[model samples]
Target: MESFLETFRNLDTSQKILYVFGGAAVTAVSLVAIRILTLKEEKRKDYPRDKVILHQIGRGPFAPSMTPFAVKLETYLRMARIPYQSQGASFNIFLWTIRRHNKKQTWNQGHGRHTEEEIVEMMNKDIQSLSDFVGRKRFLMGDEPSEADCSVFGMLSQTYWQFYGSGYENLIKDRYPNLASYCERMKDAFWPDWDQCITHGGTREATK
Candidate 1:
């Protein structure tokens, strides 16, 4: 320990600083390389690109208000035979986190009010916007499931399926029958195990 200390002390301040920086850089590079290598190996073992189009659906576990978007998107994807995955959670958590971190803001700033009612309203508006975009077309962008469909479905499914009894269900199911039907058909077609996907505790079941 004494020899190590002596050796370290022998170096000038700039050299010592450079040495620390270099060591940090090397460690960072090594960590990054390890992560890349690990990810590549995992990808090779778990999710091969040749198998399916790796798409993920995202939503919150509690906010059922996002259903319209999810259902519509799922319909388009199923019709177009686009393979994807669903990630259910609070719809805005990931995006809100990104916004907060990237712009150096708080969660409240990144998102609006934190009440369930507010969340439900936001989701309703978003879905309505998506529906308007879909118009009379059988799908979101014309008769085909575009890349946009995948994203829209992921968000919507979480809201509709997960937030069934959480006060948002009435807002959605009461007003959007087409959207409700769309969700039913999508679930029946794509996710036969719909009950299992219920991240929130089972309560208000999705009506067909």
Candidate 2:
């Protein structure tokens, strides 16, 4: 009998798409079966009591999840004071498997056809522009804080505080001292207990 790969190679274009989809469906069902079979009631003890198990795309240690939906859902869970734990699938593996060999197509769809270096350059330029706009001012609009400062500071704080070891932290700290100062100024003014609020594990403590 011909091997599966040999049979697949002989398929026409429409047949190939169907074949791939069928294989993927089988694999997904198998994974789900395995998970269900392995996770006996006895295994429940390993998980937190009464906590929700959230399944979503995995994220790198320093970056937010690539899926805005996951981020929004997680944020809602946190804000609602719901107890939950995330079980993430490997994002790169997910993309690879789902996109098959179409990496260029995936990249174009996801990142607007920009190379990694190009994306970083664009981000740095935007930050530099903001740095120049802030210049010697205490805030983005002027010396006094404005609504714009609130929005800008929220985004900047994510880079300054959460994205550790990523060059973005250094980008703001080293190249844009004014922006760094601006973040600090906003933090001091609004989040007065900022340092104390940070836990030993580097996460900020939850507040009302």
Candidate 3:
């Protein structure tokens, strides 16, 4: 008998078409038969992929930013190579509470001026601290992003993008433009779904 390859090569076009299709059908049938004989049919169980919940720290009017703790958690998750789902919320309640306390003069009387000045001074100090930390690098840490950058970016994004907040008066833009730009860069890096992260409470998958 001719070798299988030689016999196939010698077949006419019509015969070859029939042979190819017939062989495919036979192979499919054989596979189904073997599967039926050897494989047991088990009910499929759906299990979600293991993932952590990423909690966003600060919530602005149109966007949700991270807190220092949230940033650290995010960095750790990235380093560990684990999947995560995020949820964003705001601190307006807490912020309003603080303002309420301030207005009541609970701390030092309802002296908005004094409080404003003190807050500005504190912000100035924060800017200086970041300036010292960043020096002449892309981020607070260096060329590579670190946990600290995440925290700093979250904080600065609030100051830069969030104008509704009490102290978010373009301070980052006026003073630390570098840091403002850096926040943008980091946002591009970490949060690819920028608008979605903000709109759907920071949880991209949850939106769907």
Candidate 4:
């Protein structure tokens, strides 16, 4: 412990920063590797040839970006009782990039700053694609939630919550009743404090 403390104390500010970042990078890579290994081990043990794994990636709630995909996937999963893991992608990437480029003023230009027409057009495209995916089917893959459902839902839910009560509210909730209902069901089932949790936005609390 003394040696460790001495070594830590010897680190300069830059070294300390490097240590911190290096530690984080190592931890992240380790986690990814471990996850892969664990999945492989699980596959080996259970060896279900038919089983599929899904990965969903997206930004957070402020973007109003990925919710439709998530909502649709969640509904399908509930309807089908498919087990999945939800992974949150970094919204910080977009936020930081915008800030770094000093594009904050023009951030909404396309959606946040741009004309309402542009925003509407983007939303319409998203909705149309989502609708086509969901269609009359009970899920993404015909009356059953498959890997695709899980992947898409994670993204859509994040988007929906991020933009909730904002200008895009009607564009999402009002426009797609089935999708909205799906989101509500997911909230009730998965998010215990659905209203408060989803509505009040910040970093999502880490789950076990």
* lDDT of candidate 3 over 7-108, digit per residue (tens): 334533323222221223322333344344333431242324687755442333333432234444564566456888654433433233222332233223
Model 3 regions more than 4 Å off: 1-49, 55-60, 66-72, 75-80, 87-114, 165-168, 200-208
Using TM-score, rank the candidates from best to worst.
3, 2, 1, 4
List the candidate 4 regions with Cα displacement exceeding 4 Å. 1-95, 101-116, 185-208
Tens digits of per-residue lDDT for model 1, 4-95: 22333453432222222122332233334444445555466555354343222232233322234444455554557676644233223323
Q: Tell me the spans in candidate 1 whose CA falls farther than 4 Å from its real position.
A: 1-109, 112-120, 192-208
lDDT of each: 0.43, 0.51, 0.47, 0.43
lDDT string for model 2 (1-208, tens) is 4322233335333233222212334334333543454456436647778999776544422223333344435544554568887665433443433334333333434432555565566666777888888889987677677656655665565555544433343767877889889878876666554444333232432221
The order by descending lDDT is 2, 3, 4, 1
Model 2 whole-model lDDT (C-alpha atoms): 0.51
Give the C-alpha lDDT of model 1. 0.43
Native-to-model Cα distance after best TM-score fit, residue 172 in candidate 3, in Å: 1.4
By the TM-score metric, which is better: model 1 or model 2?
2
Q: What's the residue-level lDDT of 18 in candidate 4?
A: 26
Clashing pairs in 3: 105-109
lDDT by residue (tens digit), candidate 4, 22-108: 223322333354455456555565434454443332322332223344344544555476765444444333233222332232332
Best by lDDT: 2
